[model samples]
Target chain A: MAEFFTNPLVQSVLVPVAGGFILTGAIRFANGRAKGPLVAGAAVALGFLVGYVLIVGLPPLPPVSNQQKLAYVVAGGLIIGFLMDFSRRPPFYRELVYIVGAAAALYWMALPKIAGGTAWTYLSLVALWIAAGLIGYRLEKSRANVVNACAPLLVAALGLGLVALFGRTGSYSQLAFSLATAFGGFMLWNWPIARYPFGATLLLGGAGALVTIAYALALYTEASPYALAMLLLCFFAEPVARRIKLPAGKIGEAFRPVAVGAVALIPALAAVAVAYLTAPGQEAGY
Target chain B: MRTRSIIAGAAALMASTALIGTASAADNYKIDATHTNIIFIVDHLGFSNMIGQFQSFEGNFSFDGKSVEGASVKLTIKTASVDTDHEARDKHLSSPDFFNVQEFPEMSFTSTKFEATGDKTAKMTGDLTMLGVTKPVTLDVTFNKADKFPMDPNVFIAGFSAKGTVNRQDFGMKYAAGAIGDNIGLWIEAEGHKQ
Candidate 1:
């Protein structure tokens, strides 16, 4: 049992699942059944908590700068809080607040790193990512609840890919993995058959976390830009899936997630290929 | 007139003694980047030691022959210049897993105290800052030589050899903890020119 706990993979998967269940139980007790926006909000918040705990426990904590900490707290808090509130209100101002808050947080963190043209490039990328998330939220809203629920699972998959492509030893990669598993546990209650509320908020928050992790990797590590671009491209999968006409029946219902998965895979695979080829040294069978 | 001449001669003798005292004071030397080398070794899977070096580093020291305790040294190494002679491995080492060069680009050391153990050996205690973590480390340093340059008679040079060990985990480099050994051995041979 001790040896199992020592393993990185085991630690990463186990903690999040346990945390998710605990949060689920707490929310159910508090709300007398854990249905609606409250459950979704609790899951997202608790999911990140699990990841943060794992990072803290990992032998030596990486020295995060004050600016980085501020960015993470402000951006993560605003996005989660805004989504949760928007689930109840559906107010335009809620999203506006999120956009502005997240942008300011990223700018603060990026100020030390950016100079001249790089500053503009960083700003543009942040703007584009916010735009992508908002557009994704709109697309998920119009679609069935299952589409929104599945988005977290997709983010989890991306996190796993980051671990495999880069190294699992990194705190960022482990945090990403933990976040994914947490969402995975929550996704069970949010199946297509069950009409769990605030599916949109859960999906958008999951996507927001994924985007933040990817950007952080790019900024702080040798993480390839191509990989980041591919992750961003996955946001368009929802809108594109909506355009495709399918046979109306059980077949279309089964095909929806598969289509979205396939669309996401194209860029993901390309990104992996680019990473392998462009990695410092070119070796066969990479 | 004889008494005045005697006082004048004594004043002249005092001035010459002061000049000699100032001339023999501590000499300050600037580290010669081209000649100085910083190398490190770590156990690789318990099979063999993996050796690497930093290509870019600079430092300066003030050395006094009479009072070795008064000497001080400061060094700064560019973390990005870490090279293990393998490109892929070097890249991985420089990434977030090891040094995290992007976030913390340089490692620095500044001496707090120096204790002379022998005529040519001393213990240097300093704070070494790496990956944004500062820790006190003591290096066993040997004064190799100090002499006028053979090529340029006017220039003076001083050289030292130092060895120390530090746990990588101490500086937040916990990646591949078991696979790669935690204790990293450091060997530095530096030559400095008087400035």
Candidate 2:
């Protein structure tokens, strides 16, 4: 029983999902509308924080490794997201926060790499920040919609997990899966009925987690950028789901998240396929 | 008598000059990468030990064979060059879980001290930096011999073999932990040519 609990899958994936589900459920059950949604925003972040701590733990004061830097970046993004949820801020305000937050994190993270004065490296840094930052900004904007928020991002997370796995980076794969399962837990509340607000907290955390996971894999592992690019098409999940016609009853209401999920799974599966087909050919060592 | 005293003073002056010329200076040598090997070993599931090697490296050392205390060595190994006869495993090793070659491409070592334990054996203490973490390591080094190379008599060569064990976890290489074994045994065989 102890061994079972200590297993990597249980510790990394199950524990975080449980944490998110329980906390969000608690907030929905007891709290009134006063500041419930704002507090509720913290549930997914809490889940991710759990998994992050369990997997990578806390980094040293002066983070030396890339993973350590990643830990700090994710924390900063979530805090910014929480601040966003504290107010019904204008879209420009949100955009400004996202832009500045992304820029600051990228600057801190890419300092050493671009400090070498390689023009190409600097350009790549800019490109990485733009791509990752855009996904995060858009994903946060999608908090109110089901097709774009939890369900579709869930599919995207699963796809990223598979890509990381086949790319031979177990850490990134585990992180992606942890985020995917956390989204799944949170979806339990919203799927049958909307009991809680999906604000910047959950969406931003979800988006930031997915984006950073992909970014790390792209930079560190042999994962195909083409595969990641295919996964990027997940942004179209909500738009695609918007076009679908639904039945006129409770059945449609429950099936809505599922239907959107099915739509999102296409790009995800395509990403996985590309990852597998393009994986570096190598013999697995025993 | 005066002539004898003057000749003795001149002889003393010559002796001092010869002593100054014989003062020990460290001899510099370029590490012969072609003739050197850096090998590592780790336990595999408690059933066996898996051995691996790094293919690319460059280094040099200064050693006065008579004075082991004055010897110093520096080496840099390309972490991406790690090989274990399995390509996938090598890729895994290069990932963040192990060497993180993308973020930290090179592992280096520079000796801080050398303690002679015997006529031909000494311990070399140095800071080994890997995965962006540095730890002091002491290797049991044996100076095998120093002489002219058999193939090229014009080149003077010094040969040595060193072995050490390091906890990869100490360097933040927290991968499979116990299952993969933390204590990685390192074996280095090097021959340096005097330069």
Candidate 3:
């Protein structure tokens, strides 16, 4: 079992994807295959947690470091997200819950910077991530297809993973890729048609993971800020994708996820390009 | 008036001697970066041991001969200064995998206990704090010598060497565990001058 993980492919890709798919499949089945707003969120968060432990190892329990803090944040967000999914409260109640959650996660991860008098950096990151979360919420509330809604964020995760990889932090890159693959596993259940209900869970986990990881890379690594910001904006490509013409009914619906993902991929790829351009130092050959 | 002048002169001389005595008895020494080398050795793929050194650090210690009791030592190594002779690898070492220099920019050690094992050897136990985690680590320390500088006879100096082993996994640096050995071997060739 230990030697199995020693393989780079198993450590990096297959483990996360396979782990995510199995967990999500189990969750989907346990929920009586319902289409309630309680779809894929728990699966993705828990699956990513499993993959993190398998590949990167479990972080310290007290979670003193930001890396450990991140693990706790995602786990905490999973529970909070379930509340958001089940509640039919006033919009203010939900919005306030998300805001506070986002702030707490940001504070825990960026505490060193915040304590060091870099409040502006933390504020800018929180503001950008909140905006991203707001976009995810809007998608959750919309009558659009589930795949179309999740694809943009999934693509954004993919982009940030690449940015982290080329920008000198392989560990953070693995984290982002683990998240992207987790989303991929969830999206497989919704593609071509809406097989599950979409709601706050996706909104929280999808947006929350991107926001937290982006803050980490920006604050903790030499990853390019230009790329991180550009990838954050890729979520906004949904508006452009909505404007693009497609077929009249189910035919067009089948193609919508592809269209939305492709459009978002443009900026994501551009972000990766910027990361490559700004990456420090050429690789030293052995 | 003559008696008063003699007493005053004697008091002034006594005060000077007391001050000189305090200065000579001071045990604290400031580490000389120019003469100190803080380095580590780790196995790379079982083929060979890879060597790396921290280029920037500051430390101080208080030692009085080989008594080896209640002596204290403190050091702070800049994580960004980790150099393995390769520029790109050094950058990677500073990333989340190894130091995560941006989040935890400094690794520090503070001595908690010291016990004499031999005339010239002692065991120093300290808390090695890295990646925001503190672990009790023991180093086999040797007191090489402590005397006047050869270049400057009037100046006092001390030299020592310490060796230890720590598991990177214990500190949450479990990135390439099997491929890159977990037990990191540390060696410190430290020299200090009287403060």
Candidate with maximal TM-score: 2
CAPRI band of model 3? medium
Error of 3 at A154 (Å): 1.5
lDDT, model 3, position A16: 69
Q: Which predicted model would earn the best lDDT?
A: 3
Q: What is the lDDT of residue A120 in candidate 1?
A: 64
Q: Which residue pairs show backbone clashes in model 2? A: none
Which candidate would rank higher by TM-score, 1 or 2?
2
Tell me the DockQ of each model, to 2 decimals: 0.29, 0.48, 0.50
Candidates' C-alpha lDDT = 0.66, 0.77, 0.79
Give the alpha carbon lDDT tens digit for every residue of B1-195 in model 3: 999999999999999998786555649999999999999999999999999999999999997664778578999999999989988788888988788888888999999999899999999999999998899999999999899999999789999999999999888898878989999999999999988
Model 2 Cα lDDT, one tens digit per residue, A1-286 = 7456436687568987897788776765455576675546466667777776666666776898767777776677677666776666555665666666666766665555655658777776677778766665556656565434678678888899898877888777877888888777777767687656656555456566677677677667888788887887776676577678888787776776677788889998999998887776533422
The collision pairs in model 3 are none
Q: Give the B-chain TM-score of model 1.
A: 0.87
DockQ of 3: 0.50
Between the candidate structures 2 and 3, which one is better when assessed by lDDT? 3
TM-score each candidate.
0.81, 0.90, 0.89
What CAPRI-style quality would you assign to candidate 1? acceptable
